[model samples]
Target: MRLTGTLDPVYNLRYVDSVNVSYYNNRLLPGGGRITVSVPVHNNRFSAWVPPLPAGDRLVLRLRYPEMPDSAGRILDVGGVSLMTGDSIVELSIGKGTYNPRLKKFALKADVVTGEQNIARLAYLGAMRLRNNITDTLRKKLYEKTIDSMAYNTAMQKASELRDSIDRDFIIRHPSSLQSLNILETIIGRYLNKQGGWNASGNKRLTEIDNLLQALDRSLRDSEKAQHLITSLDRAREMKLIPFTGIMPDGSVFDVASLEGKVFLIDFWGSWCGWCRKSHPHLKELYEKYKDEGFEIIGIGEEFGTGKEQWDRFRKAIAADGITWPQILNDPARQDVVSDYMVQSFPSKFLIDRNGKVVLRVLGDSEGLLDAKLKELFGK
Candidate 1:
């Protein structure tokens, strides 16, 4: 790929003597490799040849001018195009107007070479904006008050409904587009992860996703992303064993197999996760109330950061939080449990019945729903 841009000569002469332009491909390769390229600006113009990328991959451009100061007057004037990628030539014109040093902003105009590329670019840009808006809105609402669980649940449910509506509109408008397929995949994956397993609504959503996938080009349908979504949907429907055996914080071996003949919950959590910490009291309450009735909880703490210091911190946090359940702290070097369970997020829970089958999967904090499930199972 090639990029061309013109930076105002005035800005170049007064503020920055030179600028560095770089592009980073945001697609993850099969072996966890990344592709990136960089080039220097000459006479206010810059160009570079990017490495070949997969068809649906994204590439982002970044600009760094070390001589220009940022808002604090200590940092560089660093700006770039937002997340954008796919096969296309990107043209950007910067510093066309007066640069405001106080605002630390520059005027930028960007365009793609082809119509098809423009559509793809707009689709991704829209999707990213929607995601950010939803997340930011929910976060603001959640932290605005002393977290009232009822209010939080209501806000989240409304946000989810809005997201679903937006996703459906995308599918309806751009059924054959790769961006639509991506949106469908995201919707289905979130449903599988968040909704209680295998309900009628869940089944209906899966059917809709499958139909949309079928409507896409056969090559697109056979893409890695599509296949992965299909597999995840299939797995969500099946009651498969998610086996885990690890050492507890107190250094005792804890195994899922050992919990046979009892109803249990496998809680995926971590010390650093705010949602996990928020749900601790509810989990402890359930465990205490039902421990005599053959109900148990196995907390698996995932530590992604380095060093035994993290583990030590986790132990202290767990104790301070009054989490008395049987706990397993993950070895950062070996994340087999996380991979086995496809745990993309923290505070995930799986309810296993006495027959050793997973009966429910809850993502995030849904303590009320979990309590209801436990009552139904134990007839409390």
Candidate 2:
């Protein structure tokens, strides 16, 4: 597709030697690749031909100025463009704009030649802006130590609900929009790592996401990516442990099945993770308090690599932290198991019941949520 743009000098365009342009397609996939190109700027004007977007796959464009900073001195995650029309000719005139209070970000207004795609682009901008605002606020709170991990997680969940509400409104208003389908897929995918199991609120979010997907244009709902997302949502509803054999630190085979019919915690952590190291003390306390009561803890150490240096670091960390629990390294043989468990972040904990069901899943507990659960279970 033909792309041409003139930038406003107010954005300090003179300092922007060139713009980094990239486009993302098949974004619903777990590992989608981005194609990027560098285009030079001359006298605040630049033009280039971007590849056409394939059908049923939404394409999102992004621009970065490696040397340019916004007036706030922040290289704001600046500009966005969402293209729904296939191979449509488009033109843009971009300019620096005032900070929008509602979206809580400094804005960049783009005058596009194609009106429909422009509206979709604006909707994408709004959704992303709101998401960034919420994320920034949470990060600030966490950085200031104003909120613990449990409260931070709770706030993040609330933020997700707010985003879903906004997306719901956008979908209802523009059921035919590909951006709406994108938003629906995002909502459905969020349930993959959601902490609580299929509880009341979880079921509500599932129903809401499914209903919104059905509300979209039939072409979008039937697309390959959308169908994949729907299948993923169905799988997320039936969560369970993937039984596997883990190799303990002493080179002995440890089958997770042996822990069945017992309450235990599976901790996916790494030695390099600061928060994981911090929680070691609390976990030790809990282990000592409840080991006699049929409670157990399993630590899956995900090191940077399986080299000798990495193993030394892992073992040294366990010794230094005084971790007495059975620790396993997520080596090549068990990497697939970690993938099966969908451990996307460090310090992911899955609390399993006697029946081997995942009662709760949390990331970076910081000793609050897990402590409470243990107390409720063992009456300590």
Report lDDT per candidate: 0.67, 0.69
TM-score of each: 0.68, 0.61
- Per-residue lDDT for 1-380 in model 2, tens only? 66667777764444555655566532222123466666888888777676655543544444556554445433234446544444356566776667667666556556675546556656666776878798789989999999899999999988877776787888888887766776675565355555544342556667777788888889878886677676555545665666777777788987888898889998888778998888888888888888899999988877764356567888999999988888887765444455556566677887888888777777765377777877887788
CA RMSD (A), model 2: 7.1
Q: How high is the lDDT of residue 276 in model 1?
A: 88
lDDT of 2: 0.69
* Best by the lDDT measure: 2
Clash list (residue pairs), candidate 1: 59-85
List where candidate 2 sits over 4 angstroms from the true fold. Answer: 1-4, 9-11, 22-36, 42-91, 99-121, 127-162, 174-178, 185-202, 218-232, 243-262, 269-274, 291-296, 299-347, 364-369, 372-380
RMSD of each: 6.1, 7.1
- What's model 1's overall lDDT? 0.67
Q: How far is 282's C-alpha from truth in model 1 (Å)?
A: 2.5
Q: For residues 1-380, could you state the per-residue lDDT of candidate 1 as single tens digits? A: 45566665654333433444443321232112356676777776777766656555555566555545443222233455543445456665555344558866444434443435445657656675677787677678668865676877887788777777777776666655667665775666566576575443556777877777777777767887678667666666676666678888767788889999999998888878899889988888898899999999888886543447657767887888898778887653444575556566778888999998888888886887798899999999
